[model samples]
Target: MKYIKKYHKYIGLFGCLLIAISCFLPFIKYSILNINETNNFFNGDGKLVLAINIITILLILFNKDKTSLISTVSIVVILIQNILTINKDIISIGKLGYIHFSIGFYLLIAGIVICIVYPFLPKEKNIS
Candidate 1:
């Protein structure tokens, strides 16, 4: 249980870093091989993605009392975004889209897993 808790924390933190990169990579122009152009998406309403990422990070970091609530909300937002993107068929279903989709999907799954396993973790004793 302790090992699982530790790995979960690490994985969540790592995912947060990836989310940050995906959120902020746009707004800067740089040509790199295999990396798709993100500036176009960033120019539009895609900024909302960044906003959600920021909010999710904060909620996960400070959600001691409401972990399940926060996780549920985060998962729902990610899942909705993925569904909308797929349904609209806007972005090209290529390498970049795959990267984006996979990351979002993994984040949602991780949040769900963490929420489910959270109760199994050892609780901190309150010392008076």
Candidate 2:
């Protein structure tokens, strides 16, 4: 449980950085290079990835007892979105596209693992 929480924290941090890069860099490249593929990647499913990143940030920020329910709900929504996107080919499979698919898959798996292990973690006792 401790390890899961630790990894989740670190992974979430990495996710933030990846989202920032993925959202901005390609768009900037497209503008400078006048490339259609870069623009297409950003304008298409990138929007969905950005939305998921926002939700993930919210979930991580509100992960304590008061917001645990919301965290769980957000995680579930993310997982469902991942499944649907993968099925619909919104998440592509290739050298150039594998990063997005990999991140989505890892996020879904990590969220589920965290949720499963969360309940077994030790709770704080109220001090009188």
> In candidate 1, which residue ranges exceed 4 Å CA deviation?
6-8, 24-46, 63-75, 78-82, 90-128
Error of 2 at 61 (Å): 8.3
Whole-model Cα lDDT per candidate?
A: 0.48, 0.46
Error of 2 at 36 (Å): 15
User: Which candidate leads in TM-score?
Assistant: 1
Looking at candidate 2, the ten consecutive residues that score lowest on lDDT are 27-36
Error (Å) of candidate 1 at residue 24 is 5.2
Once fitted onto the true fold, the runs of candidate 2 whose alpha carbons sit more than 4 angstroms away are 1-67, 90-100
Query: Which pairs clash (backbone N, Cα, C closer than 3 Å) in model 1?
Result: none
Tens digits of per-residue lDDT for model 1, 13-74: 45555544444343323223455543423444336655665665565566442553464456
Best by lDDT: 1
Worst 10-residue stretch by lDDT in candidate 1?
23-32
